[model samples]
Target: MRIVHDWLGPIELPEAPERIVSLAPNATDTLFALGLGQRLVGRSAFCYRPAGVLGLPVVSSYTRVRWELLASLRPDLVLVSTGVQRDLLQALFERGFPVYPLPLPQSPYGIMENVALLGALLGVSEAATRLAQGLAERYARLYRALPLRRVYLEFDLGGPITVGRGSYVDEALRHLGLQNIFSQHPQSYFVPQLAEVPKRGPDLFIYEPKPHRSRPREKVEQLMAERGWRLPLVVTGGDELAHYGPLFFGYLERLVEQIRGVLD
Candidate 1:
């Protein structure tokens, strides 16, 4: 079948890809959600969701791939993501690997579109459509018309990182009736000026602590105090927000509850 991908342009794919390798965590989750887990011959080390992907051979990371191991997998199709993986995608394509690059989503709706895209690529468009519709319905139910408030949301990615206009987090905040202070910025993710945060006059501060680097609420509060941030705060697990998969809606539910607890 022939389809036009945003990044890869027009491409041809087999009717049924028997063996697949997913190099991105989001793609891995989508593939499994589409009930195509059995066809996944390999996955990145970061693809730990659904618990079943763990057994697959780890052939890549976010920015690098083990060429020898990947070659051994003999995958009929290789799924990748844009952003940090752009270089990896170029390399794979030049090597004549059947690689497809999925764009990093700009919002929650983009995630659902990716589900549909993957389903179409794998010859399961009907299932993909159903999954996408279900997600949209679920999102509608989760939507709340809360009092709008300005928020400064930051992620601890070893260092401070925040989302801007073209990011899923920014859109997610809008869905919750919260305005991201950095939403006016053009870039998706970037290092924010610490001094400018307070000047933005956000009503609340949301921090997603780096994964696997657990800090107690008290410690987090202490750190914020050190920075002179006295605004209401909400701490997230850093997993679900960072991952734009089908499970992101679950995270959004938890996030809404947290925000309401703090604001209301």
Candidate 2:
């Protein structure tokens, strides 16, 4: 058994958890990346990634937990992410369940650290260490070769919302040598009007479509046309850019390629 600190507090876990439940998408991805998918008996509805995990039983989401369903699963280790899950974590603890709440990572290095911490809890510290190190090295190289460009990244076209500082997306953009036009915003994300976007004079426009939702390039073009902003637009892999996970390094590489192509 081992004891580690989580966002909620200190918790004890078995040397190797056999039946695990992940409430956050990123945690579920980390379990699979650490080769512990077989042990993940329950996951949230939104934890679909790395494929083959869609069949798992759904127990909870970041903001909600099905107490009865979660209890029935009898998970030895229940993973939670900080933020809206705070109440869920407390409920599980009072119910005598071993729930581990992971802190929300706002930056790239914080994400890597969370991966390593998860690995330690899962008894695969070495694998997690290697994963973090490899990604750091790749990101370092990309940073050195990254192009200089001011970019406007939109996660939701309906509101034309964008990420700012304190978001992993912001860190990723900075790491790739791209400047986020909304980085100076006080909040992590905010909406900008169509007419307001052109005033910033961004060199590129990056749009990340929502999962299972189709927002084709033509739609993006239409949006730009409506706004009268003729900047080059690139649509990134929705889940890849939205998710902060072990595969994010791969996503980062792909993002760098896309940026290079756009800037060239």
Candidate 3:
């Protein structure tokens, strides 16, 4: 039986989640958040949560997990996540496989909802609730009192393109009280023409510098310096953005706090 707590919302557990296979990175992280790793039988090549599962079998990539291979694994519960092999999930169901497609949450509340749902699915609802509450408290403490500002999001180094307005990062930014500079872009992820860059005039630029490519974050930083008043939000020296691990909240808080401090 599931009971909704005053602070943690609905919490419940499954009988036993044995032989589980997670196809999404975030979902993999969520599984770890619930402390249910003993059942994880398969994961994507990108699953980096817990750091110990790096040696596990790689069933697929961003959106390509081999169904025949997956079927071979014979997972009692196969987990799918947002934006990863969405269409392939339909084909899996066509094969009479009971697949669980986790819905994408747009806010921290939604993340919590997923946590509760995961707890119920994994037979550790109570533990999931406790974990969610802790993360929620941390999120609130880090973001609630900070001064909000207009923000721009960028990932690729050479390309100053920001994410789509309806992206997970954008959701995180909104919670931090920042406006997405790409909100007006017709194509969610588009390269702003030089004309548009000056017109939009974002307060910060967030880009992933090419650290592996032997490029420094300074050249681009200097190019966009603009007297240090209207610089873009750049995140240097971090590979966490490449994967959605359990500690991703730390990454979000790290970037948000830097921006908040600068804007202060």
Candidate 4:
């Protein structure tokens, strides 16, 4: 058995885990990127990456876990995310399950650390090192080329949900030379007073609508009308903005391209 330390403390793996269960979509994507898909025996409902994971046994969700089904699968290791899955992590740990919890990365460097950490845990450190190095180089290039702009980012339906300081999205925005209007807030993600938008006066606004859900254009319009603002607005897929997997690098690239198109 190998003992490893994670966000939830140290857990002992009986062996180099062959049958893995990923409870975080970002972890699932990272596993697949490391060519460890064959080791995954179970995935959470949200871990739908790598195309064929839909056939895997669904053992977890945001708030609930199928303990009976998960135990039946006999997973050697279970990867979980912090914040959203905090309660699940506690339950799994208390139940004597081999669980590894990782917090969502908050910066470009943190993302690379996550890739390297998973690589070390799974005995693929060499490959993970190469991947992290390559992604870091890509991030540097994007940051160097990015033009600074004052921006307001919108998530959720019609409300003023925004990325605050210390969030990964905030870091991503920093890399793009875009300043989040709510960056002054100490909280990571928060709902701000509506009056703050006009007082700050951002040059641009970006809206992210949830994936696979009907576009809530009316909500956006309603927000605009209520605020009486006519700033340049852009829409992006919510999943791409929120997910922290290495695959999200592609989404970040696209986001930069879109920003260049709109601002330049």
- Which candidate gets the maximum lDDT versus the true structure? 1
TM-score winner between candidates 2 and 4: 4
* Candidate 4 error regions (>4 Å): 2-9, 157-160, 216-222
TM-score of model number 3: 0.77
lDDT of 1: 0.87
Task: Provide the lDDT at 257 for model 4.
Answer: 81
Clashing pairs in 4: none
Candidate with better lDDT, 1 vs 4 = 1
Task: List RMSD in Å for every model shown.
Answer: 1.7, 2.2, 5.9, 2.0
Superior candidate under TM-score, 1 versus 3:
1
> Which one is best on TM-score?
1
Give candidate 4's total backbone clashes: 0
Error of 2 at 58 (Å): 1.7
Residue-level lDDT tens digits of model 1 in 148-224: 89999888777789999989889888887889999999999999999999999999988888665656467679879
The deviation in Å at residue 72 for candidate 3 is 2.3
The sequence of per-residue lDDT tens digits that candidate 2 reaches over residues 75-113 is 898887876678887888788888887777788787789
What does candidate 3's lDDT look like per residue over 61-146, in tens digits? 75776878888888767777655366866665567554676666645566677888888766788998898888788777755444
Whole-model lDDT values for every prediction: 0.87, 0.80, 0.66, 0.82
Lowest lDDT 10-mer window, candidate 3? 5-14
Order the candidates by lDDT, highest first.
Answer: 1, 4, 2, 3
Candidate 4 is scored at a TM of 0.92
lDDT tens string, model 4, 1-264? 556565556667755789899999988988888888889999988887769678999887765999899999988899988876888889999998888876778786787889998998888999999989988888887784566778888887445578888898888888888888788789888887877887898988888876665655566766688889888777776667778888778888988888778776
lDDT of 2 at 263: 70
